[model samples]
Target: MIEIYTDGASSGNPGPGGYGVVLKAGKHYKELSGGFRKTTNNRMELLAVIKGLEALKTPSHVTIWSDSKYVVDAVEKKWVFGWVKKEFKGKKNKDLWIEFLKLYKIHQIKFVWIKGHNNHPENERCDQLAVAASKDKANIGIDHFYESEQAKETLF
Candidate 1:
């Protein structure tokens, strides 16, 4: 079985954000992370799970550890598929949710929630990666919701 640990961070509530994923299969471990110039912490959190599943080579059993209720509850409690059926109205993280549904069908996946900042080694490492990537000067990714929300804020 493969194990994946994930975290997401944002410098400000709606500022630059990033996602981190640590994947382990057998004895090998791989780390993956990237940042968007602007986004919300929730989007990045879901994206971390999506990217981790997408990284797998074949349909297999996998367990995901996340410091996010947004991601874990949606899956563990089966809300994600219902939201998709409703076309994602009134729900957050639609982009990552759509991506996640694509991979969800192919793999036997399970999600476990870990308390963030509670000294869980893998989760803490992921948080470090996410924070570091969000602060890097070269981040090029864009978050549509981030821009949209910023536009709304400018009107106030």
Candidate 2:
């Protein structure tokens, strides 16, 4: 079984954002993180899980540990499936959710919600990685979909 711990942070709701992930399988371990110039905490939260899952090279039993209810509850409570039937109308993060479902089908996945900033070792490490990524200026990347969507919103 593979275990993944993830966390996300943003300076503001739609400001600089980042996600952190720690993946462990037996004795092998890996850490992943990325930053976006403009995004949301929830986006980063979901993206952290996506990124972690994407890193897996094969289908396996995976358990995801997350601090965000937005990510955990949506899956655990089966709300995302309902959203899919509606074609994600009136929903945010459609792009990410679609990507997640693609991965969701390929692996046997489970989610465990944890309290954030509670001194859990892996969770704290993920939080540190996320915060550092969000503050890193040189490697920051653009979240194209989010930025374009924001632009369209401003035009209306």
Candidate 3:
């Protein structure tokens, strides 16, 4: 079984954002994260999980650990699929959630909730990655969800 730990951070709710993912399978371990010029923490949180699952080279059962109730609860509570069904009305992180469901169909996934800033090593590493990724020189791209909304406002 593979184990994954994830975390997310945003300089402001709608400011620079990033995610962290720590994956361990047997003796293999890896960390992943990246920042956006503007984004919400929720997007980065869910994106971390999607990225980690995509990183897997083979099909395997994965146990994901995350401190975000938004991410963990959405899956555990089965609200993710429902959001997709409703076109993600009033829901955040729709793009990443869609990507997550795709990979989820291919792998056995389980979610575990961990308290943030605890003594867990994997969780701690995830936090560090999130912070570093947010400060990355390459912004990659600004989150479109917010940018689109902003565009709409300016058009008025």
Candidate 4:
């Protein structure tokens, strides 16, 4: 089974943000992280899962651990499907959730929620990666959706 641990951090609620992922399968391990100039913690949280699943080259049994209840509860309780049925109206991370579902259907996946900042080795490592990425000026990337949405909000 592939075991994945993920974490997300934002310097401010809608400021610089990043996601970190630790993926392990058998003897193989990989780490992933990226930062966005303008985004939210929830977007980073969901994007971490999306990125982890996208990195898998083949379908496999996978288990994901995350600290974000927003992510964990939505999937664990199957609220995402209902949201999709409604065309994701009034949802915040529709883009990431849509991306997540696309990759999600190709593999057998399970999610477990863990407490953050509690010294779980992988989780702590992910948090470090996320925080550092968020602070890395040269590597920061644009969150197009977030920026565009903010622009729209400002115009209206």
Q: Report the lDDT tens digits of candidate 2 across residue range 1-101.
A: 99999999999999999999999999999999999999999999999999999999999899999999999999999999999999999999999999999
Winning candidate number (lDDT): 2
By lDDT, is 1 or 4 better? 4
lDDT per residue for candidate 3 within 32-143, as digits (tens), equals: 8888878888878888888899999888899999999999999999988799889999986666777898899999999999998998998999989988888886655577
Candidate 2 residue 58 Cα shift, in angstroms, is 0.4
Predicted structure with the largest TM-score when compared to the true one: 2
Q: Which segments of model 4 are wrong by more than 4 Å? A: none
Per model, state how many residue pairs clash.
Answer: 0, 0, 0, 0
Between which residue pairs do clashes occur in model 1?
none
- What do the candidate models score in CA lDDT, each in turn? 0.89, 0.97, 0.87, 0.94
Q: Give me the runs in candidate 3 sitting further than 4 Å from their true place.
A: 138-140, 153-156
**Candidate 3, residue 39: lDDT:** 82
Q: Which residue pairs overlap in candidate 3's backbone?
A: none
TM-score against truth, every candidate: 0.91, 0.99, 0.91, 0.98
